[model samples]
Target: MAKFIINGGKKLSGEIKVSGSKNALFPIFAASLLTEQPCRISNVPEIVDKQVMVHLLADLGVQMNVSPHEVLITAANINKTDLNPELTSKLRGSVVLLGALLARMKRVTMSFPGGDSIGKRPIDSHLQAFEALGAITQANGVIEISAEKLVGNKIILEESSVTATENAILAGAMAEGQTVIKLAAMEPHVQQLCEFLNKMGAKITGIGTTTINITGVPKLHGAEIDLIPDSNEAASFITLAAATKSTVTVTGINPEYLDDFLLKLKNMAVNFEVGKDFIEVNAPTVDYQAIKIQGGLYPKLASDDIPAMAILATQAVGKSTMNEWMYENRLGYATELMKMGASVEAVDSHNVIFTGPTPLKGDKMTSSDIRMGITLVIAALVAQGQSEIEGVEHIDRGYENLEERLSKLGAEIRRA
Candidate 1:
């Protein structure tokens, strides 16, 4: 087990280049199974989740060449119909392969997928969409799905679930007719998947909306795609800048996705400058005001991000409420901040109220999930004295070389 020992009270100041979207790259990797040709994915993050996905692909006889930031996958000689359960259980994105396998081999058998224990994330939405498109599903302990042919039909998703919507689109892209998806997830990663499928000859419209239309293609060819930078990771850096009262530049961000979120942070008196492809966040000198935030589907603060925001709120002077409506257990990580002397109270499982300007003292902490783990690290950077953080694997599952990146920004953090 790896851990991070952070010597706190350092202002992070420097430029750090952001990596490709971990959320975007996983689905795209699974989508590679839809083609038998070679696919090149650039800007891939060298993280545990990506490694798990690559291992799963290799188990299916797909050849992969990986570097620090790029992956090339060729699936011309797939040899297995069953995905490795152990690998699949390591990350949530492993469920994405169900769509590709069902599309290509007409059958797939895999165990229940697992990842961070955030809450009850059901795969029923994925199954319902698959069954709607002419596939049969069987579940006892393991899940088995098979179909002779998938004929496209209109699918009104029960909820705007991101993974479920992506699974539906992947399955419907190769179906025989037109598939109209209502109440679909319009996250940026979903849009990237749609654009990627279109490049491979699948017809898809409504790239960034609640409803999507996909015309099935008999076969999809391999295409080259550059994954987008991770906005959530970038947001973490922005929050760190604000907490430490330092100026740092985050490079290679897509401005369109960040404008609204940055604007909200600015409203809280955080200063930042946005360029075409980068954002420079300057820390505030005076006591900052806490801002109320609500999490929603898209164009709202992402649920995965609320934990980090909660940590940032501890540095402000007033109280702030973060209402996380999506996941029930996400606010549990805030308790770690309270351990560091931050006045955070969990109103319920989903809501947390923060009373700020708490003089935090470094304490031993453990990471419950990826985002929260990193949030703890951010809190440690601003706290006084030394802090030991365990469960570093959770942090590495999303962020790549986080200690190295923070060190480049002059943070006193090291791996142990």
Candidate 2:
């Protein structure tokens, strides 16, 4: 029930270090179950979703040592094969354990996963991939999967689902013979997982391509890995700088991962300079023109970043069209922007047209999802009066010390 009180009309100016990738850490944490030895993961973000994953691991009898930015996981004495429904229902990433559990114990049972209500994010792809890897899946309110010696085969994903691709890789890495995955998601996180698996004795090739081949290994040993920085979070902060006419430097960013997003920001006339490990974005005095964005699997505007762009468009000069073909309910949070005087109309479940340079006046609003919650906070920082954002737990599930970081950049915001 925590809320954020933000006083508006302040230009944010400072440098803030970015946190580890939330998306990367979840699958990596699940991957720890693939080995009985201790797997040490660094750059772990201290966020709510991470805590949920840690709790789920504990429920499965894995010993875990958690710090602010590091985690040590030992799965030697894992005595349980099933995840608790009550705990697994807390976050969408909980579904990631299915592949790991099935690989280790040949069975997994869990209820449907839950998190941000962005839309109908079905796990059919995950189930489909599991079935493709010689596992039997039963679905009702809860899903039950079991296998007797997973044998690898060719898997062409119905969609380029990131989680499903990760699950298949995890499951395939331990299966007998070779497994080939086609039309897989080629996101940076997916590539990171493939690299980590290769380091752990699993033979994986084509790390950054749509087609991945995994050769099963009899056993995988523990290895140390540092996760890539959270590119989505960095993009959100860059959009904030552009919206509020601020200058902010984000450290710990990977330039290669941000190439596509930076180009899009450049198209909007936002000034930026990229370093080897950092990127700085400086906002303009006058509002910029609207930009069109389309979402795809990779090398496209991430669907998670659409809400942030929607908020940034409110400060732009003309109409902006955002086509979020990924999720349906993602645009629902735009109503909160309307409360702040933004002229955003949901053309359909998958599209929104925003007309702006609208004078935003702060109001009380609730966060609907992780990215949208952060977007609302960005809007609150640039809006006219004081604004209160409820459901801050959603924001905590992703960003680390968001208010503190923004405050360092001269924003007037505090957690209450």
Candidate 1 collision pairs: none
Relative to the true structure, candidate 2 has a C-alpha RMSD (angstroms) of: 1.1
Clashes of 2: 0
lDDT accuracy of residue 208 in candidate 1: 96
Which digits, one per residue and each the tens of the lDDT, describe model 1 over residues 260-279? Answer: 57866876788888899888
Q: What is the C-alpha lDDT of each candidate?
A: 0.88, 0.88
Q: In candidate 2, residue 74 scores what lDDT?
A: 92
Q: Which ranges in model 1 have alpha carbons more than 4 Å from their true place? A: none
